[model samples]
Target: EADIYQTPRYLVIGTGKKITLECSQTMGHDKMYWYQQDPGMELHLIHYSYGVNSTEKGDLSSESTVSRIRTEHFPLTLESARPSHTSQYLCASSEGGAGEKLFFGSGTQLSVL
Candidate 1:
């Protein structure tokens, strides 16, 4: 089975702070994605990568940035956090084929006060 882990499950930081949401997978999947969602709303794709050194911003525009230096790690960083940036950040990974099953991490709940 695939496994994905996210660090700092719950984070509360003051405005203008810098934070990085960590996400990693043990399944060695080739595709990884990051999504953001509110308490009750549709998920918005914020970033994704096909492989190491291949990163792309998703459909939804975001101020955060992601890096894929290795296969197992994909981290999202927000340089200056704000209240508008508060949301549940979900990390997912899947194989390189179409319709592949996605393994999702528990997610990091971030709150900017």
Candidate 2:
């Protein structure tokens, strides 16, 4: 098992539904991240943090929003999920600094019909 976790590995839902992708880490790392990937492609940064109580939106266009309440738990919530939001949500984390490798969860594959 990975150090990170994302629930509902696969989900199918109707339009206009609210969904939340859960991500948790046990490493106690201060920097956590959320990314979106298409089937198999490069990682797209959606959200990240510096430390406790430090959250920032990433350099990507995502309708989703995330919150960092604890150092180990970061969750993404979609107020109204749409078909366009259908994709894989990946969570990752690292110790600190630039160029550090990230440990990623298997991911949550969501599909809205």
Candidate 3:
């Protein structure tokens, strides 16, 4: 099983409020990723980090940003939250290499009111 974790499992916030979604893992994986999804919809990769201090934006367009300062942690930040930003944020980690399976966290559901 994956040892990843995400905080504030659910959040309700006002428009324009800044928020940070936290993700961490104990598996010592060097590759981490963030995906955005709506309920009952397909997940889209929004951000990723290959290792500490290396961050990259994913194929999907997102207003959120991310940072990777430690091997075990990757966090996503929304500078100005909006109702359109309301969605589920999932964190995942994987052992580096092609065809490696990703281990996902419980996920964070955010609502901007």
RMSD of each: 1.2, 1.6, 1.4
**Each model's TM-score, in the order given?**
0.95, 0.92, 0.95
* Structure candidate 1, residue pairs in collision: none
Model 1 Cα lDDT, one tens digit per residue, 46-99? 999999999999989999999999999999999999999989999999986427
Judged by lDDT relative to the true structure, which candidate is superior, 1 or 2? 1
Candidate 2 segments whose C-alpha is farther than 4 A from its true place: none
Give the winner by lDDT: 2 or 3.
3
Pairs that collide in candidate 2 are: none
lDDT of 1 at 36: 97
TM-score winner, 1 or 2: 1
> Scored by CA lDDT, what does every candidate get?
0.93, 0.87, 0.93
Error of 3 at 84 (Å): 0.5
Number of backbone clashes in candidate 3: 0
